[model samples]
Structure formats: structure tokens, C-alpha cells
Target chain A: MPTISFDGQEITFEPGQTIIEAAMASDLYIPHLCWHPDFPPHGSCKLCSVKVNGRICSACTFPAAEGQEVVSSSEEVRQLRLRLTQMLFVEGNHFCPSCEKSGQCELQAMGYYLGMTDNHYPHFFPVRDIDASHPHVLLDRDRCIFCELCVRASRADGKNVFELAGRGIHTRLVVDSPSGKLGDSNLDVNDRAAHICPVGAIVVKETAFRIPIGQRKYDRRTIAEVSVAEEAPLLRKRYEQKED
Target chain B: MSKKKIRIATTSLAGCFGCHMSFMDIDERLLDLAEIADFDRSPLSDIKHCEQCDIGIVEGGVCNAENVEVLREFRNHCKILVAIGACAINGGIPALRNRCDLGDCLEEAFLTGIGVTDPKVPGDPELPLLLDKVHPVHEVVKIDYSLPGCPPSADTIWAALTALIEGNAPQLPYELIHYD
Candidate 1:
């Protein structure tokens, strides 16, 4: 197994492993949206852009070859991410206070992680529609970042329920049915796509705030702390070091 | 001769006054702050008019003609105008009404609303005219800085204040900058 040096630590990985996957395995977080372990990387959300050998690339798709130097924690990267977060913030009506996914949203957590103190850019506040036609799932296009997690999730599981439509800045998520609504699609409350949305765009109806604010997953521990998949080994190493 | 104490003014326009309460959550730190800063025009002091100040904190979204006038006055008097909390930053929960027509909202609330005994929308001249839409502070006037929590945490407000006081760039840890 060849190793790549990320930030400064060497992370060993098998061939074809992306920087993001290896880093996650070693409990190193690279701020990202539109990425999940269960599917291929879409790279739609550029929040995971990192400097690999001084070239910017998506960590979730960038392969970790032998001796690859990746910088994920530089001030420059933070600034870029902050601006990107601002773009997302003003591009749509992500009025966080009124949103159901305020506490648990990955996009909101990413903004905090990057220290986006304010939305510096003038807001677009584009008008969007919310589709509550689904019996169980709610589709609030205003909150959607077009991550396509739902689209990819549906494809992976053969549901074919969600897809991306339009182009450029007009790009948006669409349902694969005769009517352009979730209710016409095959998605259900139990669908994996329904649960994979990183934002509040797709949510279970009548379940808003079921889990109290401060008790939500990202609230208890930061998205970075919770994102570390290899916490056990990292913790055990620290524990053994304490005994020494 | 003594150093001039920093003057701070805050106002809530169309919000729930949660930001002001959260500001108070600084607790005993207010004692330390008292040595360096004084309230010029704030709900805490019940001041009626904003005077010349070092910092102006505008809470809540601007939703009426009077709110616009007060916000402009704050801008004219204060050296730095900071929009605190979500309402001040991006209209917060109040901006939800931006989706519907103002006439429809008024009609729903005062005319055809449930449990209403009389359906008369108040038409008094004393009432301030409503703006066409609820607007974040920056949309109405220049905001030097903004803190974008639903009600920015006490520590977040403290960090911004002390950073301005100490004359440094305000930086916050990951946990402090929440949108909710």
C-alpha cells in the first residue's frame, strides 16, 4: 500500500482510493457536501476543493497516489471555502432560522467549519418552489443545493426517482416522473434517497424538530468529529500514548 | 483626563427580541464590559433616541417605514453598524412572509383569520406603514459586520464586541458561528 501525505500526516491507502476516503478512514476531515460512502463521487458541490501539489481539485474524486502531497487546512483553502459557502448562502433562500434542517444540515455545518461569519456577497434570493405533494416526503427547492445525493442514491438502488435538470446556474434537482413532483415519483419515506439529502430539501413530513435542536447529531459533536470513520484506532493510539 | 468609554446602541425592529436576550446572556461579563462600554440607546437602558456611538447593533429585519428611519439614524450616528442575529442578517423567520403578498398576509391575519370576531384591518394613521417586503439590514443600509445565528450566542456577541474593542479581526471557532 502506497501512502499520501495529507496536510502533514502520511495516510496509507490501497490503489484507486480517493483522498477524501483515505482521509476519512484516518479521521481527517475535508469539508465536503454531495459526498457519501455508499455512492460514487459527483463533485457537484465544490466545498471539498483542496490543493493537491499546489493544484486545486476535488478531494472526493482526486486519487491518492503514492507520495501525493495534499493540503486541506491552509488559510487560502479556508478563504476559498468561505467564499464558496457565501455563494451558496446568497444563491438561494437558505434562511437558516426558519429551516427545519438548521441544526443537522451538512451545508450549515460546513459554513461554521469554514468560519463564514457573514454572507458578504449580495444575495440573489432566487425564487423557488416547494413541493409538498409527496405523502411522506417534502421537497423544498429553496433549501436544495443540487447535491444530487438523492439522484445518485436513487440510481444506485434502482429507484430512478431523482435526477438533475437544467444547466449552468439554472441547474436544479428534478424527479423522474410524468409530473415534476415527488409524489409522482416512486420515492417513499423508506427510500435511501429520501434519507441521503445533505440539506433540508428532502425531509420526512410531520417529523420536523422531532429531535430537539441542541440534541441533534451535528449539535452534540461537530460534523468533523462525527465524520471521522476511523475514530476507534485514533482514540486507541491516543490512549496507549497516555499509558507510556 | 480619562479614556472615553465606548458607546454601544442596539435596537430590535421586527424580531422577537431574542438577540437582545442572548446579548444579556453574557452574564457577569457585562461587569467587565461596563468598565469600557456604556449603553447609549438600547432596550436595556430604555433610551428613546440613538446618539453618537462607537458601535451600533441592529437586531431584527426591517419591515416598516419607522424601522427604515431608525436604521438610517443608527447608520448616521454610529461608527460601525453591525447586524446581529439572523433577522438582522437575512430577515430570519420574519422573511417567510416575503413569499406571500402583503395584502394577502394582512387579509389572512385581520380579515379572514380563524377565531376573529371582527374582520377589520386596522386603518389608523398612527400605525407605521408596512414595507413591501421584509429586508435584512444590509438591504436597507450598509452593515459593517454581521453575525448570523437565529439569535447569535452570547459568546459570539462577546467575541465580536471584544475583537472590535481590542482592534483586531474578529475570528470565531467552529462551534460559535451557527446559522440557527
Candidate 2:
């Protein structure tokens, strides 16, 4: 067993367990965006970054070893997370006003919680198109954070509908075939990508305001808080039971 | 009282009280703040009416008529105006509404929606209306300092106040530096 301490709380884990899994197994919260238990760790959002022996590493994917000392809430950790979240904000056109996902939006909540006040960086405001082709869903390219959660969900879940085209800063989510609008792409709204979007980039069409602002899923809890509970075995088992 | 001792007023306009609360969240250190500064007009203090203060901290956003009046008065009275919080510094969460047309929102919220009140909504008001866009404080007024954050962490707040108390420009911790 490998042991680790996050901000002084000790947790032991089996070999190969990620710091995120170990932290959650012992009830320690580590904030994250692109890492999910069911899905492999994609360190894009970088919110789950932590300090390991005074060095920054993404906890969602970092391997925990014997006597590994982790610091989750240190100033260093916060600084990194803040920059990452800010990058996500400026990287997209996240005007919350016209967005149907305002309260439910994770990017807004994280930005606030982490104290991102100014977009110190220039707003790229890259020209992105809104795909309203999907009758049941809307894809606003400007709002996408490129977490690849959607891509992972589609591929892992065997749908093969969503895929990343291009590379690096120019990367984007695109339909699997014909390059037609998502509505014409034969994609389903119930796909995993639709459910895991951290922002309003992908939203269900008809139910935009079906749930009021204050009542959306992640509005009440921090991203760390929600993911920790979801990672628990008992909770996962219970969720699976409900689905079955 | 004694030659106005650099009158400083703190007020919150369209934002969560957290920034103001964080100001008070300084806890016992507030006693130190009280000693050096004269509280003229602050939501936390009794003195209303901006009586030509030296510094004004405007929090939140300009969503209503009252906000416009308060912000304008602060700009008029204070020698230095600081935009605090993401809401005041930028449009913040409230600015999210800026994406939608105010006229349409007014109709949806006050007229056709479930919370319909006076069937006839006022087409105009006494206060100056916000522009089609909700802008950051610097966009509206000359901001002396911008302490950003949904509500910046308490440590950042402490550092800012300490610097102000010491008559030195506050240095935001390097690790705390984040551009929204």
C-alpha cells in the first residue's frame, strides 16, 4: 500500500491509485474538471492540480507512491488552479448572460470560487459558430473548453459520435462524419459528452430554462465537492443500481 | 469630525456582500482599520450620503436604478474609486444577463412570466440606463485598483487592507495572481 498526506490528512491507497482516487477514498476533496472515475484522466481543465512536495502536479492523474506528501489547498496550488480556470474563461466566449447554463455552469462557479477577477489576458474572442442543427441540443463552439470529456465519453461509451479535430490550441469538437451540423450528425443528446460538459458549450435545446438558475446541479457545491461524492464506491454502486 | 481625516467610504453596488463581508471578515483587525480611517458612508457604517470621501469601494454590478445612483455618487465624491469583486470589476455572474436584451428580460420577468406584476412596465426611468453592455469598472470609471475574484480569497483581502493601512501599494501574492 502507498500512503499519502494531503494538507496533513493521511490516506493510504493501493499501488497505481491516482492521488485523486486516494484522496476521495479517505474523504479528502481535490477539485477537478476533466477527470472522472468512469473515464480516464484528461488533465485539460487543470483545476485538480495539487502541490506534491512543493511542486505542482495534476492530482487527478498523478500516481501516489510511498510517503508522498500532497498539498491540495496551498497558495501554490490555488495559484495554478486560478490561472487554469482563467485560461478556460478567456479561451472561450463565456458570456453568461446569453447562456442558458448560467447557474449550472461549472466554469463560472470555479472562476468565482478561485477569485478570478480580471481577464488579465487579452480576450481572443475567436470566431466560433453556433450549431443549432441538433433539434434536441445546441453546440456553441465559442463556449467549448476542449476538456475532451465529450470525446472520451463518446468513444468509451461506444457511440463514436464526438471526436476532436485538429491539435493543440486549435483543437475543437466535431461531428464524426460528413462535417454536417450535430443535428444532422446522428448524435444523441443522451450521450455521455452532453452530460459531462462543464460549461454551457453544449446544452439541451428545449429545456434551457427548465431548471431555474439557482437550482442547477453544480450551483450549490464546488467542483471538488461534487466529484468526491461521485467517486465513492458506495455512491457509484448506488448510482449504477438506479440506472439498472 | 477632525478636519475629515481623509474621509473614506465603502459601498457595495450590484454584487454579493461577500467582498464587503470579507472587508469585515478581517475580524479583530477591523479595529486597526477604524483607527486610521474615518468611515463616512459605508453599508457597514451608519454614515449615509457620500460626503466627499477620499476612497470608495464599489462592489457588485449595475443592475438597477439605485446602483447607477450609488456608483455615480461614489465617483463624484471619492478621489479614488476601486472596483472590488468580480461583479464590480467585471459584469460577473450578473453580467451573464447582459447577453440577453434588457427589454426582453424585463418583459419576461415582469410581464409575460409567472411573476407578472404591473401589466404595463415603465419604458423609461429617472436614472441613467446601463449601456447595451454591462462593462467592468475601468470601462465605466477610472479605477484606481481592481481587486478581482468572485470574492477574492480572504488572504488577498487581508494583504490589500494591510497595504492600505501601511500607506503602501498592496502586492497581491504571486501565487494569487489570476486574470479573469
Candidate 3:
């Protein structure tokens, strides 16, 4: 194990741990969109951009090295993080009130965490499709942030049912079927990829409002609160295995 | 003598009046709000015309010509106009109709819906004409502020109104600033 410096604090990490993983292992929360624990880092969303050795890089993909200095909470980095989150908001039709995932969406909670009061960027309002072809899943194309979480999850889980198609600005989520529909795809309700969507883009149909507002995730406590709550156990284990 | 309480006006356009209900959710706090502000041209007050109020709180989207007219009148009268709730800030649920053709939507509801008997589109000169698309209030007129919630919690309404009454920007806590 080697130690890396994150935001002026020393943190220990195993070999080959990304800065984000190391930070997470030590209970440090970094704002992220595409990075998920269940899948490999795709680094699509740059919301986790951090200053590594004074050079900006995505913490989720950048490897943590011994004595490496990582900065995530500086004034410049904070502004960039805010702008990135705002861009995501404007890019999607994230009418939080109308969405079933409102109270629980990590993206929305990120907006709160970053203190984004207004979408400084212009809203794209792209008229995307809401695919209700699946009996269980609702595919709201408008809410898709293009994080490729579904793609990564399906690939990792060996379902290989979802993929991000198109090129550049024309990019969009696609189902792996001739009919181009979720029902035609082999996706089952039990797949980890089925539950990997951070936003309301993909969700279980008929389960809307199952968890009432104010009683939902990120409602009682912020995403940061939940992130830190995962840190205590790791800290205790490290203390027990501490080497003189 | 102290200046008159901040005159406040409110109205519902194409919404379900849920935001107004949330406003009423203030419960006993409504009494406190009354001390610092007076309702004018609001459903609660039942006033017919807006009287150059200090603040105007609008809920819902602009779905018809009548909504546009009412929204313009509010802008003409109030010193500040705030779009409250999701419908006011954005079209919310009603804007889902933007996906459908207006004529086809009308036909589906009146001409070809289930359990329809002798159905007519209810065309009348007195009836407000539908706009081609449902629009958030900002699309029609300027809004001084926006309170983002489905039917913003009662606490949110109270906090926003109190801030407006105190001549400051309405800053809500993250817990209160939900879209749904």
C-alpha cells in the first residue's frame, strides 16, 4: 500500500487504485456522474475532473500514485465542477418534478451538492424519445446524460444488451436489437445494468412513486452524507491492520 | 403610519392548483404571512382584478390564450413576478403534450376516446382557445424568480414568500429545493 495526498490530507490506497477509488476508500467524496462501483471506469462524464499535480484530470480514471498531490476542492476546480453539472442539466430535459426519479436521482443531488441554483447554460430541450416498449423498463431518452452507465453495466454483467450509438453530438443510447426496442433486447429486470442508471433515463415501469417523496434517497441526507457513511468501516479496518 | 403590507397576487393557469394548495399548506403560518402581506387577485382572496401588487406568484404552464392574457396582466401589475412550482418554471407534466399533435390530441380525447358518447370538442366563443403548445410562464413573460418544485412544499412556499416580503431574494435550502 502507498499513500497519496488528496486535498491536503494523506490517504492510503492499494496498488492500481484510481484517485477516486482511493478517495472513496478513505471516505472522500468526489462529485461524479459516469463512475460506478459495479462497473469499470468509462470516464465519459467529466464531472469528476480533479487537479492532479496541478494538472486537470478526471479522478475516476487517473491512477493514484505514491506522493501524488490531488486537488478537488480548489476555487478553480469548484467553478469547473459547477459549470459541468450545469451543462448536464441544460443538455437534458431534467424536469425534476415530472420525473419519477426526482428525489432519488444522483444527478439532481449533485446539483444540490454543487450548489447549482440556476442553469447558467442555455437549455437544449432536445426532443428525444420516451421508449416504453419494455414491459418493465421505461426508457426516457430525454433524461439520458450519455454517461454510458447502462452500456458499461450490461457489458460487465455479460448481458450486452445496451450500447451508446452514434458519433459526437449525434450520440444516443441504443438497444441491441433489430427492432431497436428494449422489449426486443434480452435485458431482464434482475440485471445490475437495469438498475445502474443514475438519472431517470432508465427505470422500472409500474414502480413509480414506490418510495414517496421526502422519504426517498438523497432527501433526508445529501449524496455526500451517504458517501461519507461508507467510509467509517474502511477506516476501522485500516486502523486494525495498521502497521508500525 | 407604517406602509401597507406587501400586496401579493397569485393565480393558477393550466395547472392542477396544487401549488396553491401547497401555499395553503403553510397552515397557521398563513396568518403570519397575512400580517406582512395581503392577498389581491388570488383564488384565496377571490379578488377579480390585480391592483398593482408588490409581488405576483404564478403557478402552472401557459396552455391557452387566456393563460397568456392573465400572465401578461400579472406582469403589468406586479413589481416582481415569480414562477412557482414546476409547471410555472417549466411546462412540467402538461408539456408532455408537446410530443403529440394538438389536433390529433383533441381528436383522441373528444372524437375517439373510450366511453365516448355524442362527444364534441366543446367549441364556444366564451371558451378559452388552446395554444398549439403548452409553455412555461417564462416563455410568455418575464419572471423575477422561480421556485422549483412539483407543488413546492408548504415550507418552500412560505420561505420564498417571506423572502419576497422582506425585500430579499428567496433562497431555499437544498432539502426544500426539489423539482418533484
Candidate 4:
């Protein structure tokens, strides 16, 4: 058993476990954009940057090694994560006040966790079309951060309904269909990728703002804190009842 | 050589005084600050305007007419200009309206909505022209440093001040890496 400490709390892992797997088994969550248990880790979003023995590395891809002191809370590491967050915030039209996602949004929670009080960068103001194509969902292109979690989930889960187009900053997630809408695509409502988005960029239609403020996931604590507590038996039972 | 007594000035522009209050929250660190830096024309201290200082901390967004003049004066006077807090950094809450049409907001807030009075826009007055959008300090003038928080925690202010005293780039706190 090799020992690794996450934020100074030591945990032992089997020799071949990735940080995400070890963290999930032990209840620590490394905030990720392109990682899922069932699907292969994409490591595209880079939101999960953590310090491994003083070097910043993505936790989702990093193998947990013996005697490694991983720090997710160092000043330099947190700022780097925040810059990614800021890029995402300004990259999209994140009007928290008007958004139906408001309090329930993971993007908002992460922004709060990262201490993003202002949109410091230039506003892209990229015009985006709203796709009301799905019967139960409203797709807003302006809100997408291009994390590609949706594409992986759809592909891995045998649906193969979603994909990404373009490259670099212009890259975007696309639904596979003639109309290219979720309604037109062969996606089932039960796809895990639809629910696993860290932000409400790809949300279930018409359920935006359904949960009132002070009731969203990670609303009270950082995702790291929430994930740590979620591993406990008592909290796990409580969390299941609230899971969407 | 003895520690050079750095001169400093502070100005509050078109924003709530929260950013200025953040500086005051430095508590006992002000005692150490007095030893290393001399207050030149800070609103919180005896000074009223710039008297040639080493650093200037500008608080608030550029919203009204007087803000531009004051900001320019501070930039011209201080050797280093730092934008303090969310308002100075990114126009804060006021900037939310930057997305909304200004004419619509003015009509709703002043003329047709609650507390209605058709007020004439002042022309030959001391009032500054209102820009269509709120702007961060850096957009108007060059900024040497930016301390961003809603009102950056007192710890951040202290760290930034101490870094300036030591002539080093202050590192951000681990708890606050993403400031807008």
C-alpha cells in the first residue's frame, strides 16, 4: 500500500489506482472537467490541477504514488485553477442572477470556491443561439465551457449522441442529428453525461432554477469538502435522496 | 541604508467605500505600515490629494464624471498605481448593467419608474460623462498591480503592502487565487 496525502490527509491506495479512482473510493473529489469512472479520463479541462510534491499536475490523470504530498490548497496552485475558472467565466455568458441555474449551478459554486468576484478578463460577447430543440431541455451555446465531459459520457455509455467540433478556443460540443439538437439526437434522458457536467452548461431542459437558492449541490461548501463528506456512510445516504 | 519611507495615496471613486474599508481592516499592521510608508493624500488619513507619493490605491469603478479626473491625477502622482477590490478591478456589481442598455436602465431607475422625476442631464457642470459601460481601472490608465476580492481580505492587503515594502511581487493567498 502506497501512501499519499491529499491536502495533508494521508490515504493509502493500491499500486495502480489513478488519483480519481483512489479519491472516489476514499471520498475525496478532485474537481474535474473530463473525468468519469465508467469512461476514460480525457484530462481536457485542466480544472483539477493539484500540486504533487511542489509541482502542479492534473489530479485526474496523475497516478497516486507512495510518499507523495499532494496539495490542492497551495496559493500558486489555487490561482492557476482560478485562472482557468476565470477563462471559463468570461468565455461564457454566466449571468448568475438571471440564469435559471443560479444557486444550483456547479460553475457558480466553483467560481465562489475560487474567489472569482469579478469577470476580470475581456467579455467575449460571442453571440450564441439558444436551441429549444429538445422537448425537455434548453441548450444555450453561450454557456458551454467546452469541457468535453458530455461528449465522453455520451460516447462511452453507448449513446454516441454527442461530439466536439472545431479546435482550440473555437471548439464546441455538438449533438449528432440532422437538426443538431438534443431533441433530434438519439440521446436518452438517462445519459449520465447530461448530469455529470461540472457546470450547468449542458442542463436538463426546463428544470433550470427549479431548486431554490441555498439548495444547490456544493452550495454550502467547496466541491472538495462536499466530496470528502459524501464518502461517509451517513452522508452518502443523505446525499442519495437529494441526487438528481 | 535605512528602510526608505514610501509615500502612498488612496482615492475612492464611483463605488461603495468597501474597498477603502478593506485597507483600514489591516488592523495592527497599520502600525508597521506607518514605519515603512508615509501617507500622503489618503482619504482615511490626514491627506486629501496627491503630494507626490510612491503608491496609490484606487477604489471603486469609473461610473461618474469626477472619477476619471481623480484617477488620472493619482496615476500622474504615484510611482505605482494599484487597483484595489472588485469595483476597481472589474467594475464589480455596477458592471452587470454593462450588458443591459444604459438608456433603458436610466429610464427605469430615474424617469419612468419608482421616484419618478424627469431630470435634465447636466451639461456645463462638474459632472463627468457617464460611459455606456463601466470599466476596470486598467482600461482607463495603466495599473501596476491589481488586488481583486469583493473587498480583498485584509490579509491580502497586508501581503501586498509588505511585498511593496520589500520591493517584491506579492504572491496571492492560497485561499484566493481567482479574483475577478
Candidate 5:
């Protein structure tokens, strides 16, 4: 067992756990989007960036070490997270009012948690395609944040149906099929990839606005509260199961 | 001695006036607000032009040349400009047009749309020129504060306004701050 100081609070972690995993096990949220318990660390979204011993590092990828001091809730880290959230908003067409994933979306919840009052940047307003070809699911590339949760999930499922192509600002999610469409790919409705999107990019069909505006997840509680109460328990259980 | 009332002005540019309706949703609280503030130019007052005011609350995106002109003029007249609602903050639904070509949008609306008898784009001199894209108010002018929501709840608007009137920064709680 190793101990690390997270935001001035001493927390314990196993030898191989990342900062995020260690934080979750202790019920301390680091405000992450790409680091889910079921998947390996992708480290794409930098919302989980924390200052480890005065050096900035992605908590999802940074290993928790003994005697290390990690600052997650400091003003500097909070401002950085806010700016990253704003950048994510402007980089895509995140029209939350019109988006189906408005309430349940991790990005939207992160924006709320960061107290984002405005976009604070000019919107890129890039043209993105929407693939409604899939009978059970819809692919709206406008909302993708390149977190690659779906990419990992599909690969873990042995589907390899989703992949990232292009580079820099031109990078986009592409299907494995020749037609470059979700319907033409081997992605099934029941696949983990279909339900793993942190944003509204890939959503099940006929499930839009299933929950009312004020009643949805992240509507009543803040992301930090929800993450600790709902997600931390599951993550802790998984860790305990692994140990047994 | 009586306190000097704060002057507030508001306007809508390219929105559905839903935000304005939300403001009116303040309901009986409007009477409480009237004691501390006076309306200079607003939909409630029916004033066409803005006057020098302590706060200028604008709700809408900049879609046409007239919107830009109005926003600039409004920005110049107020000490603090608050962009209220999703339209004023992020262009809202009108920004969906940003993905499409302006020419294509006009042609589809007037010329190629269903049941179009006389198909021609209007070029009247009186009409304001449409901008290439719908932009949030901050893109056109500097906004002092932005309250995000489709139409921010009456309580949220009340909280921000009262705080602004008292010369304090708006500290919206987690429940009050929502994009939708």
C-alpha cells in the first residue's frame, strides 16, 4: 500500500493504480471524462489534469506514487479545466439545448461543474456529418470529443468497428466498413461501444429526450457529487473483486 | 433619503423571444425589482432605442447586419452587458445554419422548398443583409457576463439581476447553471 496526498488529503492506493483510480477508491473525484473504471486510461480529455508535486500531469495516466502530492481542486487546476471545457465546446457543434444528451452528457456535466459561464472562444463551427444509417443507433459526429471510449470498447469486444482517422484538427471517427457508415459496420446495438460515448456522438435510436429536462442525471446533482455517490462505489467494488 | 434606481435595458436580436418571456416569468417579483431599477429600453417598455443604463441584458445571436449594429450600439450604451440564454451565449439553434451555405439555406427556404409558387430571393433595400453565420453576442461585442440556458429560469435571472444591481458578481449555484 502506498499513500498520496490529493488536494492536501492523505489517500491510500494500491501499487499499480493511477491517480484517478486511487482517488475513486477513496471516493474523491478528480473530474474526468475519458477515464472509466471498465476501460484502460485513454488520456485524451485533459479534464483530469492535476498538478503532481508542482508538475502538471493527466491523473488518468499518471501513476500514483507514495509520498506524492497531487493538487486537483486548486484554482489553477480549476481554471485549466474550465478552459479545456470551453475549448471542447467551441471545437464542435455542442448545441446543448438542442442536443439529446444535454443532461446525461459527461462533457456537459463537466462544464457545469467548472462553472462555465460562456464559451470564452470563437466557435470553429466545423461541418460534421451525421450517420443515421444504423437502424438501432445514430452517429452524430458533431458531438464527438475524441475521447476514444467507443474505440476502446469496440476493440475490447473484438469488433474493431470504430477507428480514428486524419490528424490534428482534421481527425475524425471512421467506421471499419467500406461504406464508412455505422449501419454498414459490425457494431451491434448491444455492444459496449454503442453505449459508451461520453457525449451525444453515438446514441441509441428512439431514446432521445427519454428523461425530462430537469429530471435527468446531472440535473439535480453536480457532477462531483454524482460521480462520488454513483460511480465511486462501483469502481471500489471492482477493485475489491480484483483483489479477491 | 431615497436610493437612486439602477437603469436596465434589454433587447432581443434573432431569438424567439422566449428569453424575454422568461424574464417576464419573474411574475410578482417584477414589483420588487421595480423599486430598485427602472427600465430604459425593453420589450416591456416598448422603447425602440437604448439609453445609458447600468445593465444591458441582451438575448439572441447575431445573424444579420442589423443584429451586429444593434449589439454594438447596445454595448456602447451600457456599463455592463449580460448575455442571457443559450442564443446570446452560443448562437443556440439558429447556429445550425452555420453548417450550411447561406445561399443554399435561402434557396431551400424560398425557392426549392415545398409548395413554393413564386421562388425568388428577396433583395429589398430595406431588408438588412444576412451574415454568413449566426454568432453568439460575445463574437460581435464584448459581453461582461453570460447566463447560459435555453431560457434561463426566472430564479436564475432574478439571482443574477439582483446581484448585479447590488454591484456584486453573480454566484449561480449548481442547480441554477444549466446550458439547457
Candidate 6:
């Protein structure tokens, strides 16, 4: 077993593991939005940025090296995360008070974790369309963070139902169907992509606000606490099975 | 000798007044707050215009020309201005109209809306003109602090007010901070 210094704490990691993966295995959480354990790292969100030997790198894609010093919670890294979160808020129509994902949203939780009290930048307030064509799932593009979790999940499921279209600032999520609608696509309500959105973008119809406010996930506890408690065991089990 | 009391003023524009209600939710703590602070131009005092004050707490977004004027007045008069609740921080619900054309919105509400008696948009000169878009307070003027929530919990308001009165930056715990 090789060891790395993560924020001055010694943690052991197995070879071929990314810094975020190793951190997860050790019950540590590096704040992230796009990186999911089930999918390959996308490094799109950049929320998991950490300093590796004084150089900033996306922890989800950066390989953990032996004896490397990883600074994840420094003032510089925290400020970077704060600005990134603020950018995400201003870049989208993230009216959290009216959003169904207010409490459970990973982005909102990340804002709370970063102590973000205001939208530091002027909002873009981009005009976006909502795809309620699907009977079961609704695609509210207004809330999409372009994390591409759904894109990867649908691909992993061999559906390829979602894709990112357009260029920088104009980038958007589009359905892979003839009519360009979620209803016309092959995405069933049970698809991993349907429920994989970290935000309220692709929510199952008739399930909005099912969990009352203040009782939803990330409400009572911070994202760091909830993420570590729920993900650490799953990662540990997966690694254990891999060894077997 | 008595210490000089901190003068605080508050106002609501384009909001439901829920944030002001939450401020009142501080309940008996208002007694404690009154001991150290004097209400200047608040809903409680019924003062129409803001006077020179130590703190100005604004609740709502800039939806119409009047909101911009009121916010600017607070910014000019107060030593520190705090934007309270989601509306003031990011144009909470009223901003939903940002995606739609203002003419469409007004026509829908005044002309095409269901069960309308007289379909006519009001054109009174006294009515404040609507802006093209709803904007958070900071977009119009500098805000020294922001306490975010739908109507930030009563405890959150209390904590922030006390901290500001004491000349200390607010340090809200995890449980106290929420967007909804």
C-alpha cells in the first residue's frame, strides 16, 4: 500500500486510484459535482480541484502518487471552489427558493458548504426551455449545470440518450432523439440517467417536493458529511470485491 | 454614561413581506435588540424614507424603477447595507419572468388572464415603471452583507443582526444556512 499526504493527513491508497477515489476509500470527501463513483471521471465541474505538490489539478482525474502532498482544504482551494460555485449560480437560472431540488441539490449543498451568502457576480439569466414532453421525466434545462452525469449514465446503460451540444457558454444538453425531446427518446423513467442528475434538471414527474423541505437530503447535514457517510461504504465494498 | 445605540432601518420591495415577518419572528429577542438598537425607517417605525443609519436591511429584488431608487437611497444613507433572503440576493421568484418578454407578462396578467372583467393594462403615472428584468440588490448598489434563504429562518436573521450590531461579521453555522 502506498501513502499520500492529504491536507497533512497520511492516507493509504491502492495503485491506479485517482486522488478523489482514494479520498473516498479513506472516508474523506473532496467536494465534487461531475465525478461519480460509477462513471469514469469527467473533470468537467472542477469542484474537486486540489493542490498536488503546489500545483492545482482536478482530484477526480489526477492520479494519486506515492508520497505526494495533496492539499484539498486550503484557503486558496476553498476560495477557488467558492468562485466556481458563484459562477455556476449566476450562469444559470438557479432560483433555489423556488427550485424543487433546493434541499437535496448537490450544488446548493456545495454553496452552503462553501458559506456562499450571495451571488457575487451578475446573473446571466439565460433564456432556456423546459422539456415537459416526457410523461414521466421532465427536462428543465434551466437548472442544468452541464455536469453530464446523465450523458455518461445513459451511455453506460448502452442508451446514449443524452448528449452535450453547442460550444462554450452556448453549451447545452440535448436529447438523442428524432424530435429532440425526452419523450421521443428511449429514456425510460427507470433509466439511471433519469435519476442521476445531481440537480433538479431531470426530475421524475409527480415526485417534486415529495420530501418536505428541511427533511430532504443535505438539509440536516452538510454535503461533506452526507457524501462521505453514503459513498465511503460503497467504494470500500467495490474495492473489496475487486481484490477478491 | 450610556453607549450610542445602533440605528437600523429596513424595507421590502417586490417581496411578500415574509422576510420582514421572519425578522419579527425573532419574537422576545426584539426586546433585547431594542435595548442596543433604535429603529429608524422600518416597517415597525412606519418611516417612509431612510435616515442616516448604522445598518440598512433590504428585502427584495430590483423589479421596478422604484426598487432601484429605494435600494440606492439605503446604500447612500446607511453605513452598511445587508441584502436579506433569496429575493434580495438573487431575484428569487419574481425573476421567473426574466425569461419572458415584459409585454407578454403584462398582457397575460392584465389582458389575457382568466376571469378578467376589463382587459386593460394600468397606465397610471403614479405606478412605478417595471424594469426589463428583476435583479438582485447588489446589481443596483453595493451590499456589505447578504443573508440568503427564502426568508432566512428567524434564527438566521437574529444571528446576523446581533453580529452586525456588535461590529462582527456573521458566522452562521451549517444548520443556520439554507437557500430555501
lDDT of 4 at A154: 76
Q: What TM-score does model 2 achieve against the real structure?
A: 0.65
CAPRI quality level assigned to candidate 6 from its DockQ score: high
DockQ per candidate: 0.53, 0.12, 0.34, 0.13, 0.87, 0.85
State the TM-score, rounded to 2 decimals, of chain A in model 4: 0.85
What TM-score does each of the candidates earn? 0.87, 0.65, 0.84, 0.61, 0.98, 0.98
Residue-level lDDT tens digits of model 6 in A35-117: 88888889989999999999999999999999999999989999999999999999999988778877999999999999999
Model 5: docking quality category: high
Q: Could you tell which candidate, 2 or 6, scores higher by DockQ? A: 6
State the C-alpha lDDT per candidate. 0.85, 0.72, 0.84, 0.73, 0.93, 0.93
Q: Give the lDDT of residue A153 in candidate 5.
A: 96
Q: Residues B1-180, candidate 5, lDDT per residue (tens digit)?
A: 999999999999989899999999999999999999999888889988888999999999999999999899899999999999999998999999999999999999989999987999999999999999999999989999999998999999999999999899999999999898
Instruction: Estimate, for each residue in A22-77, the C-alpha lDDT of model 3 and write its tens digit.
Output: 88877888888898755578897898899999899998899999999999988899
Better of 2 and 4 by DockQ: 4
Model 4 docking grade:
incorrect
Residue-level lDDT tens digits of model 1 in B1-180: 788899999999988999999999999999999999999999999999988999999999899999999999999999999899988887778888887899999999999999877899998998999987888888888888888787899999999999988876677776678888
Compose the digit string of candidate 1's lDDT tens values, residues A1-244. 7999999989887676788878876778888888776678898788889999999999989888998899999999989988988888877789887778878888888887776767777666667888999999999989989888898888877889988889987988788878888899888788888888888999988888888877887776777776674343554454356569
Q: Which clashing pairs does model 3 show?
A: none
Colliding residue pairs in candidate 6: none
Clash count, one per candidate: 0, 9, 0, 6, 0, 0
Q: How far is candidate 4 from the true structure (C-alpha RMSD, Å)?
A: 7.5
- Model 5 chain A TM-score equals 0.97
Mark the regions of model 3 whose C-alpha exceeds 4 Å error after superposition. A1-17, A51-57, A63-71, A74-83, A95-98, A116-125, A133-136, A205-208, A230-244, B117-128
- CAPRI-style class, candidate 3: acceptable
- What is each model's TM-score for chain A? 0.91, 0.89, 0.92, 0.85, 0.97, 0.98
Q: Which lDDT tens digits does candidate 4 get at residues B1-180?
A: 996799989988867888788788999888988888888887777666788888898998787657888899999999888888867866667766776677887767766777667664345665577777777777788888888666777888888878886778666654543342
